[model samples]
Target chain A: MNEKLDITLTVNGRSHALGVEPRRNLADALRDDLGLTGTHVGCEHGVCGACTVLMDGRPVRSCLTFACQAEGAAIETVEGLADGDRLHPLQQKFWELHGLQCGFCTPGMLMLAAGALRENPDMDDEEIREVMSSNLCRCTGYQNILRAVRAAADVMRAEGAQG
Target chain B: MKPASFSYHKPGSVSAALALLAQFGEEGKIIAGGQSLVPSMNFRLARPETLIDINHIAEIQGVSDQGDHLEIGAVTRHATFHHPVSPCPLGRMLTKVVANIAHYPIRQRGTFGGSLSHADPASEWCLVAVTMGAEMEIHGPAGARRVPAAQFFRGTFTTAVGRDELLARIRLPKLPEGWGTGFYEFSRRKGDFALAMALAALKVEGGTIRAARLGLGAVGAHPQRLEALEAELTGQPATPQTFAAIGARAQTMVTPSGDIHGSAEYRRELAATVIARALTRAAEDAA
Candidate 1:
């Protein structure tokens, strides 16, 4: 048997230091060990974005990454998008647009879209679709998801100008 | 499924990493970003006993402009190449193709060297490196040696990197003025694996073709340069008709295998379409 490894990670502004096996993935660590189950695990093979999370502010498939690989890295899961029960603009837009159906892919979709909006605040519909195409949501045909991103972009821009 | 058990080491320096590789021999696998290797391990496709993680090795980190060539570190993330502050048009082209790879999440963890070392023929970085005449530097106990892209890739998921060697950096020659470039790929869906892809770089001088480099992917064991079509285009008049004629000639140069997404005949037709579209885009970029 292999020895347990020491890992330190910061998720949603909190630090965690734990002993993990060498084979444990970041998604498993988030859901099983850390009890941050907002980041789902659909296809452990990376084909599904249900395991997406933000590593140092950039979206990455947590299922395909080893927990030790993220040591000293800052992470953000779906649970980090809220501020004391107040939802993010993207979360509100997703709720208003009915962007989710079965809700299995929502956590990953929200994280991916939030990262895209941060990188490009003025992305159009076609651009949003092209960027979000990497994240697969079987229930929603993706039309409403595209609309939600567009609507959220306006809300984020307005909030930015006001501040 | 969980990955097989393995020992992990993250060395802080390149020399220490190379020393670790030399000590571990065939039991070691160097991991850059773990975008490809981690999934393979999880699926039990690859079972290396020891993983030499090189992500913390600072020597192989960023892009450097060296006047005649751009020296890109092996560990440079795909996101860095896509940023607006990148120096070359090739960086912008890479950014566009990288965005279409898997998704933003995968790109954030995928390193330039990881893609090259993975050696997937359908991968964007492999095709672009072969087309642009990039050079790879490998370090071992004997020190560093440079291998040209033309001689680097051995076959599907295979490279010339030896067991004791580590890919250090990739050097890409800067594009000369008046050079046009294009990259086109046809896939069943956007962000899916490519069925067929083509890359073209042409240097047109005063309406005449001074030089041309054409590369085709997903049609062979390794991405290949179309030397026959390149020879035919040199010194010829640059025109839409000439490009179409060359595209037809290029169709015969490669024989792609039949797969689930596309038939062999369909892929042949797509080769022509991709090449023609790439040439037109390249010409427009040059103009």
Candidate 2:
């Protein structure tokens, strides 16, 4: 409730103008101000990647980014992944492969994977596990998560080659 | 937890940012990527009255190859070193060290100048800077000055960058031809802070070590160059015996304090092992 700074950010292809405190982080602004809520904050520090989001096509820790710093940048959250009724291929693979049990880390994991796949769709199992290890998960033991990302990568690569 | 209230200033130019730094002095902190500073602020560890965001300063934001050296802008992201958008001769060594720095998301936002200014003892960039003899270009009200990496880091979490100055660029010298480098790290986790690490770059000619540069991290208050080891390796055959002896000598060079991560004794032993392994790798690469 101190002095609030005005910022305009493009989130999920939609522009939002809001007044935010300089101290407010990006994860809080997205969840509280915009009501997106998909980006969860577990550690609130850079160690845990639960608040991961794509910033201008690169995955960044939203909890570590101030809302004021995100002005004029394009951000993509987990809510922006699905295409209306149809789930993203990564989301479908996660559901089919049981990638989540508690589902707390699923949103951040999806955002990280989406960004990673977008950059390189031909990631192998080791690369997938190595890249996904940033987002810590206590629930599903990570085997299913690894399998899900692999499956999604295969599908995404085939889809990319097709179109 | 959230950070306390503070004013944010996004300067459009490097001079404007420096002016803000001079105006605020110790009360101001520069934010390049905010990966480390924001987390510390959220934990209530750092509460600067004003945050000078230098991310918008376009002048200090990319890599420039200067023929003999690579000039990396202050705001150059860690991910850029891994998959360099521009030409970089230090690509091999950078790829190995970048992966060992935190994780993918952190690399996406963390910057070279931020890491250098933060000056964590276990930071891979600090070790790399010392091993490569890089220079830090700093700008302030007094104008610009370049400090060699050896004199840049003062102590744990401290550097030569004045409170009213900003790190503008890092100048990393080109490795000489016939040189090979190795970065060996032993962190508890893949992307966690290293418990102990070794950086080695060697030039072997006619099966003899011509020149060697060695650095150790997480075994002391700051990453330090092992000048004695470097001198001892000169003129000797690049062999396992020499590396073993170098490892033993390196164990006596550091003074590490016992902490939650590990004991001083454990770190010394770990440092020796990593040094030996790094030397072997560097020799193989040179061959």
Candidate 3:
């Protein structure tokens, strides 16, 4: 018998009150309990970074973070990135620049870049490459991922400046 | 894979956390960032019955400058240092070193005090702490005790912290105005554990090396200061030849074991090269 924690996670501007066991990871809670399967889990260990998500505006591995640990945290998954049907700037750039082949690592890459660019909107190509190196992508060879993130960063900056 | 079932306690204060840690003894663990611990737990390597999560303890969550030193709280996130924490040159050095620790997201969650407590030989924080002469403040059932970083690390993944004790804070001495610090590391990938790394702090005055501190990591079981090289550097000119000469002696000082990543002889060679590079950078950057 394990203890179940009654916790509330604010995901994608929606509040989800979940009673989860202490051992249940945040990725599982988001996918199974909340029915948000966009957050993929490639490696339960924190290596692949496939389950990356934004907790309080900082990117973190959902697989390593326990659901209980994320209590009261503002969780932002891939499902939260789009404004209705229209794609976010990062997603648009990834699609136009051919950032993915298998799409297994696309969600994590997008979230990681979103979090990083939000904090630093004026990153150069080298800096974008360095940040993109955090996640693994077997199919697209990473060049396209870096190009997509850098291009999206420019677009996001332009949109913010216009606003 | 998930962590084995355990009772999780989120303590608001250091004393409360220490109390729970004391009560659980060997069956307990303090989960900081869980960047390293959670991975091991998922692999079924660590099965603690009780988890003391100190993330909510605001008391142990930031760094404070104490004129000559910095008192970094135990749970202070590594992201806090992304921007310089102190005006001292040590802050710049720490920023440079922190960049090499894993990747972006891991740094956002990891902590300086957690890295010191983990005491991985390849850990850049451990190398910096041991090099800078950091003092660790630990709380336990008996009270609190301060342990120097030199004596704090026992071996790979082992430290001076006892079963009932918890690392509360780390006090690192700030480098003076004229000193320059340098760090160099080699790893297989962008965010892997360093195979060989060197950290050097140098103070040059009037074309002569007045002070020097050198530390090497991941070449052996524990990170340690190169006192012999430090002594050799002092009183010598700040030149590439001098640094290279001292670097060659690093292979003789350390007895590293061979692993799949590198042979013992290869690590010894890497140690010398990185040490030389770090020293050269330090000399070039020193004001």
Interface RMSD of each: 1.3, 1.5, 1.1
- The DockQ leader among the candidates is 3
Question: Each model's TM-score, in the order given?
Answer: 0.96, 0.98, 0.98
> On DockQ, who's better, 2 or 3?
3
lDDT of 3 by residue, B1-287 (tens): 77789888898898999889878888889999988888999989998888889888888889999999999998898888888898788888888888899999998888887888888889998998888899999998898999999899999999999888889999999989989888999998888999999999999998699999999999988898998889999999998899889889988998999999999999999999999999988888795
* Interface DockQ per candidate: 0.78, 0.78, 0.82
Candidate 1 local lDDT, residue B201: 81
lDDT digits (tens) for residues A44-103 of candidate 2? 987778899999999999999998899888999999999999999999999999999999
lDDT score for residue B11 of model 3: 87
What is the DockQ of the complex in model 2? 0.78
Candidate 1 Cα deviation (angstroms), residue B4: 1.2
Q: What is the TM-score of chain A, computed separately for every candidate?
A: 0.97, 0.97, 0.97
Q: How far out, in Å, is residue A98 in model 3?
A: 0.6
lDDT of each model, Cα atoms only?
0.86, 0.90, 0.90
Comparing 1 and 2 on lDDT, the stronger one: 2
Provide the RMSD of all predictions against the true structure, rounded to 1 decimal.
1.5, 1.3, 1.0
What DockQ does predicted model 3 obtain? 0.82
lDDT of 2: 0.90
By lDDT, the best candidate is 3
Q: Which stretches of candidate 1 lie over 4 Å from their true place?
A: B84-87
- For model 1, what is the alpha-carbon lDDT of residue B154? 96
Residues B73-95 of candidate 2 have per-residue lDDT tens digits of 99999988767443343767787
